[model samples]
Target: MSNSVEYQQSGSVAVITLNDLPVNSLGLDLRTRLLELFRSAVADSSVTSILITGTGRMFCAGADISEFDNGKALTSPLIPEVFNEIDACPKPVVAGVNGAALGGGLELALACDYRYAHPDAKLGLPEVNLGIIPGAGGTQRLPRVTNLKVAMDVILTGKPIKAGKAERLGIVDRIATGSDFLTGAIEYTRVQTVSKNSSDQIVDFKGNDRSHLEDMLKSLHPVREQSKLACAKALDIACTHNLEDGLKMEWALFKECHESPQSRALQHLFFAQRQATKVPGLEKTTLPRAIKSVAVIGAGLMGGGIAMNFANAGIPVKMLEVKKPALEKGLASIQSVYESAVRKEKMSHSQAEMCNSLISGTLDYQDLADVDLVIEAVFESMDVKRQVFSRLDEVCKPGCILASNTSTLDLNEIAAVTKRPQDVVGLHFFSPAHIMKLLEIVRGKETSNEALATALQVSRLIGKQPVVVGVCYGFVGNRMVAPYSREAFRMVLEGAAPEQVDQVLTEFGMAMGVISMGDMAGIDVGCAAAEANADEWKGDPSYQALQFKLKELGRLGQKTGHGVYIYQGREKINDPETITLSVELAEKHNIERREIGQDEIRKRCMYALINEGARVLEEGIANRSSDIDLIYTNGYGFPSWRGGPMQYADEIGLARVVAGLNHYRESLGEYGELWFKPAPLLERLAKEGKSFKDFQP
Candidate 1:
């Protein structure tokens, strides 16, 4: 029996159990054992039918994503090879799914002759969420099991389909009812093997596009055939393109995403996000307390949205705002979001009402005395947050975990004002907390394990994925963005118009470009952060120049109808006036302008962030690479496909990236801050021909 997987003959049946815990992941070890098991099962005369099931609750979650960053995996073709062997097995193979079967898990099951799923099991191919196409047999096998339309949807969106839906789609043979999933599957297997059905007989799957999708392809546009969103209008893209062509299209699209600055930035963000939680040397432990009731101080956008998550999770909450008007506004905002969810069919009207009923808005801090946790979503100002935390220190219960939703602030300083620093933590929520999935759980220097546990548990209860991080000025996500933005602005100075820079990025598969993002976030926000950093980092001259000039001119982005570009309502109206103004400012500062290509803009913008992330890792801001990826993927819309920035660095090859950085450094001669120098860890890794991927964190 191998450590990752094992198979044993029990009379005529080979019982194949995946030994990986929690969820049996298709890592290098599992793939090796699975292959060995399949070989013995196929060759042994005593074995007739093979029954595969996971040891734990899950059949298989997917591949070992963490292994993607592991250095030894630079060239491994095990999962695909194992899947091929499973598909080519001479005897009938049965998959007994005890829990989830996702991505490669679902791909492996699809290759089997029949699949029996537990009632609670979910099955799907969700590789798209990570910004990569399923490199496994998903693109090939899914269409064979179900209609091409459904396969396209599953492959593109990566949404998990329940067992019932999987059965309806003909992806599974039957749904077993018993709590003992293996017993139910074995009984079915016994009945099937006893029948006259031939061992070599292949299972039949009817694809919806089998008949006419070929003809449908002649009339479709290239973009419609290529873009995932465009598939909505045309209906059957797989019908038009051959299976090989479709796979190529997927790879091409994935490559486009890979080349994107947004993808690059997002990948960096994903890794950075995962690193957010490693409080240096803090012991990871479970606490006895569970958050049943929550007190949200400051019923503003973040507070109200966070309250919705709690109520939706069946937790009762008391929402505290400063005044009656503020309370009413917060409640109304909550109601509006619920109504939107109802319209989208995300939640039932009754469910919405139940969630709404769980939240009570009031003005008094005393109402939070008995709450299990209190999260303050106060204004970004340190003085304001400090005052709110001080008040919470006086009123909340001794055991109640105190948290701040402030995106950027020193959690330690805020905790210092409290009676118990160990009880204070930072649980930073992305905007529209109810809608977004990522929660940044920041632990200050004195925060206890119990406090961290409460925050992490509460995050799950609210239907949010929480990645904990250590405290910094802007925490993990925001701090990393500084370098990326600096280079984006640098592109503007280098004679690439905002739209051209944006176009290249968007074409590369980003939702939008840096300029559009800046416009969306508002220039004032960046200007303000830069101003704060200018004073905070102490005579940071480069940041000071942009901050002081932008604020002095009152050029505040969308809210002011102008900043980098003018806007009318929601549509952006780029006035040549902006370009002229920008150039004038550059000239006034005597900064020379030169032509820059799309590639140059992207490299500078993205690599800048990755370089900064290396320092964060070395400084112990993040525990592991996975935590950083979890943050960016969940909170910042960092594309999951490239595996986060540090992962991307590995993919890009750090030695190659380091060479590019030094080249850029020479290019920027005078203006280059010695801070642009690579981190010691990064320098060592590059010299050794290693990548950021070498460090799991």
Candidate 2:
């Protein structure tokens, strides 16, 4: 037997401890050993009761997710087989959940006659997050212990419940408080009555009203259609079938989901998100500089939002503005966000007040001298950013990390004004910085390792995903977005309506369409960013021409109540003027307008984004392909289920993507050829019949 599972005897109770460190993930070896120990305990004449517990912080995280794609996980004595062995044992089996009992771990506990969990233990079936249903009898067993409503909620949403809540729901029989879980479980199990067959004691809720099940399904209806279908099928099997039949049906469904493209994409993203945190060459032992306090230079919306992140993390922040009114306004905006949270009951009044208390407003640059870090959230103009950095260099103390919150400006140029260029980095927080999860950490050419480390550490403290990218015109996200937006604009000139383009993208699982997103981000903002990279865009005259025209006409998106579409209190209303404008532009350029299908629109827009992502990878702007995926999913509203652009390209087959790009280039002639040419890396990968998964950089 493997040493991962150890068996011992305590009086009449057989104690089986799972000794695997770091959350005791049940792999093939551990599962095989567990089966051996369980059968041994059942056969021993002296052992009347069995107590299963785990050493270390967790009982078991789940099945070893690393083994999902490999065939080894399907070997004999699988998790379900082990659960069945435990269930069929004649002795009363007790599960001592020391910490988390998630996914298959929860299923293991459910197989036992009684469950006792540590107070801090969390229990749930979160397989839905990876686009699969619980395969090892979770759907059938969870509903039996808890009601259908609670079970569906837990399974569909993939949220864990605390042991206390689980106990209240009767999912856990008792809380093993103030004592070691194994000792408590042994003491509790010693007095329990042994049944002729423990498997027969499974909770039966066959006659219960299931109207609440429909309500729960309705509540989860907004998730992806595929996920909703999985949940519905699981619920149907649980509600209608017997235990054996339900298990068989669920296993089939689980296998189908596991083989699905959605599951593969989601699983790819699951690993990608974790892989994004690891810097290739950076030493693991290198620690970040100490950052206790931060200051923001500007009193605008961006500045206030940036300041709120530090304050929310319990770090003191100073907000600086040129005048007192502007400073007060910025402080008021920060306070309002907290107050709104209080009104929604998301936070206590005391917590809101405490968060607000950590922020202080100042009119003088000298007030920032004691701060450990200073971030400039001023205008996007290089002149404005340089002035702010130059002033910060003069007033800030030595060793202070200087950062720019510029989403599109050149970070190196901004850092050039300061003598301490090594300290300058980019913290590109999306709009509503306090709430958005993506924080692009732009490493300038001169940025030091210490400064990069500090920014990454601070991002985690503030509950953000920091993707460290090298400096460029628009960095990773925006630079890729430029091509994507270019295609959306060109589609308008080719006879597709703005709403049609938006609808096609939304159907493809984008959170918002390109035209609508541009309107929300403000047409002027995109125009200014485009103007900054004019030399790069000089080959295409019609690039963002409609946006420039809209800006000239004073239709500045949602803020101005007009842009690509007219807005009526945040609702986009189709207007005839945009179609008229597209026709005029098509005539001016001597281009023919024709009916464009949704598929063509989707291919053009998505291929543009994917091609740019390839260039970003080849240019070393991003460290890896997954980093681009992370940036798009977290920052640019790319669908997470599709696994971002690169993974999506891989799923579509690189050769097919190359063929599609070539088709567009040949169809549209000169400008199209220039724009639609696939990146060299993408072309090579396609010719080699390899996916982005084969990319090392």
Candidate 3:
């Protein structure tokens, strides 16, 4: 037998162990070997029962994801065949779920006559997360063992449940008693007292339950369009047919989803997220500095949120402000957040209290002297940031990682003001930092590997996805946002209504419309940021004219109840006043108020960002195209199903994106000429008949 699978006999029980390390992924070789061992054990008359378990923490993650890119996933003795053989076996087979049994792993367990899991084990079919449903007997067998509600919840959400919950839901037959899961599983096979029907023998569901299941699936508001397909098919297989027919149908449905553009995109993101973690030139053996305690400069909203992230991770934090009033306000804000979380049951009372206790407020910079790290989340001003960093350089202890949370300033310039330039990095956390998952780790020119490693480590500890980026204005996420948001505002000035512009984007899978997003994020805030960098857009005086006009009119956004749209309670009604203002500005600026098509709006806005993303890649600001996608999907509300903008551009074909940009450049006249020109990298790739995926960077 192959080393992937090990077979041993203990008395009348035959034990088969999955020896694949990391995660016992059912690759071609592993699947082939396991089948051989199973057949051999069945042929031996001395083996009365079989016990299958994995070596370590993971029973199995699932099928080999890498194999899917090639035709190896569809090779002979596929995952389904292994499950079919196990299901058809005459001898009783038991699965020992010692750890997480996800996706095809759970399907494997379902094929067994009985399953025993350690109390800490996690089990679920998370194929929906990858834009597919379980392809084996998962849909059929899961509904057979558990109710429709449990099966729907488990399959649709793609979230793993604890072993105790699995036992209650009837997904797992019994919870293993001892810490040694394999020993308990072997003993279970030997003493076989409880007589239970195999998964195939159990009926799908009661007559009345099918309608309820259908309603439940209908009520599901999945963000991804492909999830609707996967969910509907999973429900049909569960409620419509027997195991034999269902498995065949499941494979066909799985194939359909696997071949879809959305599936390919989702799979790309899964691999892209993992690849983003690896920093070039930073060895895997590099040791990160231990961050025992942290300090936050400025106790504003961003600083408070940043402190909460460290505190939530069980690290002590000191928040410093210039005055006691501001510090008190920040502390109160943190307390309110924790209190709300506790009320919503999002955090346990004890956990919330512990987190709150970890955050301490002070007014003196000297109080932060002993902190291992200092993050300056002050105003987005160069002079202000430099002053904070200069002071931090004097107060912070040796080797303390000095970080600036500046969203748009130059990190290298900020580092130059500090004595320890090598220790300075940028931890650009998104708004409500503790909640947002994305963290842009900006590596300054003089930043050491130790600083970068520590930032990555800190990101993991705080449950944030870190993407290391080269120092640049706005870094990766915010830098790309400029062109995307610019196009959104410019389109509105060109005659598209606020709602119309937003509706087009939402229909195309964006979480929210750009015009509405501007309203909600406060227009004045954006105007301020734009004015701060006024020197960059001096050539185009009419740039963001409507936005500046609104700011001048004291229409600030949701906070003021009137910006681009009039807010009435939670609903935003189209304000004729803003439209009238936009028309006046358009006429004054010699811009025509022509009707804008949805398709044009989408292409212009999306391709603008894609073009900027290509420029980011060409400039080496982003290591890979997928890293940009990761930032947008996590930080910004770019649809995960479409992949990132870069992936979307690849799928639509780079040639097509270039054509759109060129078309808009000529169609919009001066406006397009100013903003719609495709990046050189993008043009080169399109001319070469390649995609962003083909780009070396």
Candidate 4:
């Protein structure tokens, strides 16, 4: 028997404990051992009942995804085969779910005659998140034990439910209240009557109204449509087919989805997110500095949102502004956000009040002296940032971490102004910082491991995905976006309408088009970022000319009700003036306007981003190719299903990407020749018939 599974006999009950450390994943070895143990218990006349439990916490997480790509996942005694054996066992089997029983784990429990779980245990079949449906008996057995609606919702949404909810839904027989979950399960099994398998039961969905489900299916965004289709198909099979046929149908569909490009991309992203947490050269033993109280330097929108993060995390936060009125306004903004949540019933009034109470406002920097962490969320200006950091250096106590929420500024330069460069880091939170999940943690040249570790810890405490990156102009995300946005603007100069550009990107699965994103982010904001990096855009005359023109005309964006398109409340309508301006700019630059195809528009914008990402990878600004993908997916609204720009490029084939770049370089003349030159890394990989995945940092 495999060491991962331990078998012991207690009276007439055979207790089998799964001992896989760190979440018991049901790999082939564990499945084989479990099957052997079940067969042994059945063969033993003394053992009339079998109790299955896990050592430590986790009953099981799911199939060993790390072995999915290899053939190990399909090895002998597969999960379903073991589950079938358990169901066929003459002796009664009870599953004691002490922790998370997700995906195949839930299927294991379903195969048992009865299941009991710890009060805090979670159970669900979340295979849809990996772009695949459950392959085991989850699709059929879940509907058998629970109603069709409940089963469909659980499997389709891929969300875990608590033990209490699971018991209420009849998915679990009971919630084990005692500290000894195994003992509770064993005791309950002793009194329970032997029953037919769950598969013998059938769910009646013929009279059920499925309009709400259909509406939910239709409401899914385009990027998630493929996964939704897989889910819908699985649910249909579960409702119509018998247990054996339904499991077979689900397995076929699961394989189809597992082999799809979307599945590969989503799976890549899943692993990439985990990889992003690891920083190279940082010792595992390096501990983070303790962060108790936090201080925000500015009381503006960004400042207030930053403060709300700490407040939500149960950490005390102090908001500082230059004046009392500004401080009061900032505090109001924070309160209004929490109040809206309460009004929407997302939180209770007491919870909102408690969160607000954790945040206090001040007008003086001296009050921040004792705070463990100080984050400067002022304007995106170097001089302003330097001044704030200088004051923080004097006022903040020793070992205090100083962070700047500068999205694109040079962290090394900002750290240069302070005596403790090791203490300075960049925590670039996305807009509406309280809601967005991505937090780019910029590590400066002189940054200490302890500081970086602390920033990563704080990011998690505030519910953010922290991607540690090297310091550079625009960092990893914005630097690549610079070329992408440049191509979008240049496409307009070549006679592509703003709506045309946006439509192509949105159709390709981006959350929004470049034009709409520009309007939402504010054209003036782009102009300011450009002006801050004026040296980088010095030679390009046509760079962001339309945005600069719009800024000059005071057509900032949605804030001013005019940008690339006119805004009527939340609706954006095309404006002839913007089109005329683009034509005028083309004529001023002595460029001929020509009709651009949607394919060309998409290729230009996406390739520009991909090529720049290669440059970022070559420069070591990003640690790995997948790190770039994580930033684009989480921070830049890039489609998670397509993976990030780097992964997308790998899917498109590096040789093909290079061919497209070279075609644009020769065809579009000077501007194309300048911008479409593939990065050396991309060129080398293309020449060698390789991919971004082949490049190791």
Candidate 5:
């Protein structure tokens, strides 16, 4: 009654404005007000057409997340009622979409007879990423409004379609110019609203003849069915209601998702993702320098991947490799990845070629001057990396942001050689940088806030999620990884075989278990990291035996056709000689071998990683729990459905986890103290019944 919804009558049209703050979400109060506004328009005899829009940057961000984020049971009779009420409105209700019309917001627009979008608007139904289908009439009305395939595509993938694409798809009636979006919608309603004198058609599908669409289906069996079934289910769920009955069906599904265990996890994940970027020192963090062009030093796997990421971001890259053959191979690898995307239909041939043209290879240091940023992705050796940074400091522009793609090197040492130490930052791009969604923005002590923000923006441009991290050994990923690997070693010392361990973990939703993952990543790398730590753990005879035995054998990994398991054509056909050596070495030290249960195996691997993650948070290495989750989910293939380890910890209860860590702390003693002891941050939060969100970045 107090104007939660406001009416601005402009001549022949009645404009209903939703003025709720912060993206104008359609929550319970807004829903009630929406009903009142529709009734007001209906009652006014002068109102011929209705133009509904929002008084914010976005039309709406869908339902209020506050309603469900706290593990609430979703009750029925939800969004469907609202949608049906819109459909039942006798007058033409036109929607003026501006900015993001996502989730239930898009569904609200669909309830209108026609939709008008601004040039910069984005439309999407992103429920699937949260582990729920479109519960609102999205499933039903979308297919009827567009073709079956187009509806399925929008629902399944959850990617936003541009205003131009939406108009072409007939999802929007028209695309408006840079004027008041509502004015165009009102004009459209004048032409479209039907009276007794003018009969109106209830159809708006006007898409191109996609008759050849079926031929694009996958030729492969399981992959074809996997794609087809996923698409079909998206539409099938939508067909449960007609336009008038839409609201009921939509609310029912929405409620199902609201009460789902998956939804609970996703809500935690959403909060975690928000936390991920919040590391301390953001107040002083400078944006990265504008990266229009980049120079990459080294053409090895990491360097090539860095170049490819820049190319994909539409930044011109001059890749400088020391040797001719190395440069050729790096460029070839970039081509191969792009070619694979085309073959898989992830990209068009033209688009792939465009991305490829952006990367250039050379052997000259003179090529570095014009670039805004120069990232050295050479060997992991400290001296080599320091030399590269020194050269970049001399040759590149004074303002050029310098970066090292080192997973474990010190950013301070790298920056010490550069004249402009503030410009130096660590851009730890995971393997196959272009494909990975994470780019760790590790700030050195002198790195400014503008540089940090610039790095965050550039990361978004390059299609990556950036998490600004504090400078430390191993940064965040490898730092936490050390404890996770320690647990893996402890698992081996116990009676569980590598295959058994892998099976238990794979079942937990990882793509591969720890042992198989080691083989896939090359055991030589892990052994190298361990050997570097040999002196630190010298007093512990057990660790020295495990490290030297692996180095003694030629069982490096799949690259050498042996590691944790022997490989034949991507198949592990034989048990590894290194594993037998490890077992023998353990027995010789009189280390007791008791068969560890599957639950313990899973807990040791996951909890160790999670415990270290908390430690990283306490030490200010990572900004937020969500940032770590983003790194793991996108970079390390941690299953999105379960959320990241931080989210999983919240779901499983931090109190329970703390107790488990305490158990390990007592039994495993000193080695356990290094990896098994839960962080004080974790202990406090658990005891207080709080969450990772309780901490500041």
Candidate 6:
């Protein structure tokens, strides 16, 4: 046997221990060696039963997903064949689930005659998370071993269940109570009688099975609609066919889902997210500074949310404000948020109390003197930021890091106000910071590697995906979104209704259309952001003119129920007044009104984002194309199925993207020349017939 697997016989039990460290994923070499050992154990007359367990916390993570791209996944003695061999063995095979048994890992457990899992082990078929269903008899066997509801819940939701819950659901035969899991499994395997395999169990598919399947489908809330629908269809086939035929049918459906555009896009993001954690130019040996305590400035929604992230990470945090009333109000707001979470069962009361206890409010900068990190979440004005940073520079400790949560301002300028510019960095968190996953760590010209590394480390501690980006307006996400928002506003002025524009974007897989997003985010906020960069819009008087008009009329979005749309409760009703306002603004700006098609709206907005992303790369604002993809997918609500705008551009081919930009430049006339001018990098790549995937850092 290979080193990946350790084979030995304990009494009558042939102990086959998986020695692969880390996740112990089913790679080609590991799979081949495990099968060889299993067949040897079956052929030996001295071995009575087999006990299979892993070396570490993970019994198995799953099949090595990277192997699929390298063609090793299709090599001889595939994962299914190994499972089939175990199922056919004369000696009973017992699985000892030491930890997480996810995807193919859970499927392996099902092939055994009996399963004994550690109490802390987590088991589930989470293949749908990668845009594919369980192809290794999981769909057919899970329903046979457990009830249909449990199977549907496991496969559809793709969330793990603890061993206690798995035993309750009949997914696990028993939970091991001892400290040494392998010893307990060995003793249990020696005493157990031969049991029926999951594949040989009988299931009833009687009385309106289709209706039952539909009802099960309705209860599931998978991330991807394609995965949800496909898994449901696969389950229906599994119920209708025998074990041998059902495995074939399930494999076919799994292949269909694996080869889909949605699968490809999701897989790309899965890898890209891991890649984003690695800093390009930073040295591998650089160590991150310790962040023991944190302080957050400002006491508004953003400030309270930012503080909660540290508190949740088990780090004590202080919220600072200039006045007592603001400090009291902010602390009260934070308590209310924690209370709401407990009320909704999002977090247990004890967990909420513990996290809430770690947070306190203060009215002085001196209280932040001992803090390891200070993040200013004040207003967007540069003058206010400079004043705050200057004060923090004086009050903070010698090595304490000072960070600004400015979404669009220049980080280098913010760093300049501080005497310790090397310790200054940008930790831009999205609104409702405790919930949003994306955190853009902006690196200034003078920012030290230790500061950047600390930001990245702290981001992981707070469960946020950190993307290291260079100093620029809006960094990566907001900078590229500027053009996307511009196109949405311009289309409304040219004749598309706000609802029509929003509908096109949502249909194209944006979580929310740009128009609805602007309103949801507050129209006044948009106007303020545009005004912050007023010098850039000097030549175009019509730029964001409609939103400016809306702000003047006090129609500041959902808060007022009358920004660009009339909001009756949660319903978005079209407002004739908004249309009238657009017409007036269009004529005042001397812009022509014409009917716009759905395809045009999508192309103009998407291409604008893609073009700007290219410019961001050329300017070295973002580290890599994949980094931009991760920021957009995680932060901006760009559909993961379409990947990021850069990946989407690659999918359609860069030549087509450049061609579309040039076509618009000639058609939209002056507006096209101003906004649709292709980035030089994009144009050059198109000329060379290369894609963003080919562009190195």
lDDT of 3 by residue, 540-607 (tens): 77788888999999999998999998888898888988788888888888888899999988988899
For each candidate, give its TM-score against the true structure: 0.81, 0.96, 0.97, 0.98, 0.86, 0.96
| Model 6: residues with Cα > 4 Å off, grouped in runs | 70-73, 204-212, 215-224
Q: All candidates' lDDT scores?
A: 0.72, 0.87, 0.87, 0.88, 0.74, 0.88
Residue 339 in model 3: lDDT: 99
**Decoy 3 TM-score against native:** 0.97
Q: What TM-score should be assigned to candidate 2?
A: 0.96
Q: What tens digits encode model 1's per-residue C-alpha lDDT throughout 1-697?
A: 5677876666688888998997898887788778887888888987778888888778999877665432333245557657666766777788888889987798778767789998889998765454345655566566666656677668657799999988998888999987777778887665555321212232233554444444444553343123333322222333445444544554445445434433444445544544544445545656537788998988888889889888988999899988999999999988998898899999999999899999998898888889988888977888998899899899888798888998878899889888889999898998778888888888788988877877766776777777777888678888887777777776675577878877776664445676677767767777767666665445334442443455567867787887777778988877686677567667766678888887887788677878878877777676666666666656655545455677767777888778778888787765554445677778889898876656654
Number of the top-ranking candidate, with lDDT as the measure: 6
Cα deviation at 637, candidate 5, in Å, is 1.6
> In candidate 4, which residue pairs clash?
none
Model 4's alpha-carbon lDDT is 0.88
lDDT of 5 by residue, 1-697 (tens): 6565688888778888878877778777887878778888888999888888887788877877767754555444356567667756788788888778998889888877788888888999877666565666776667666666678678767888998999999788789874767767667767765521111222232333222233333331222123233334435434433444443545555566556556666666766556555556565344446778988888888887888887877889999998999999999988998999999999999989999999999998987888888888887888998888888888888788888888887889989998889888888898777777788889889986766767777777887777778877788887777667666765776567778787877777776676776777776777767665565456566763553465567667788887777778877864755557657877887777787888998888888888889988898788777777777777776767667788778778899899999888788767666556678999999999998767774
CA RMSD for every model? 5.5, 2.1, 1.8, 1.6, 5.1, 2.1
Comparing 3 and 6 on TM-score, the stronger one: 3
Q: Model 2 residue 557 lDDT?
A: 95
For candidate 2, write residues 40-97 as lDDT tens digits: 9889999889989899989888888787773544778778878877877778998999
Question: How many residue pairs clash in each candidate at the backbone level?
Answer: 28, 0, 0, 0, 24, 0
Candidate 4 C-alpha lDDT tens digits along 82-192: 887787777788898988899988999999988889998899988888877888888878878877788888988899999999999999988888877777888877765
Give residue 294's error in model 4 in angstroms.
Answer: 0.2
lDDT of 6 by residue, 519-565 (tens): 98899989988887788678788999999999999999998988999
Sorted by TM-score, highest first, which candidate order results? Answer: 4, 3, 2, 6, 5, 1
Candidate 2 lDDT (Cα, 0 to 1): 0.87
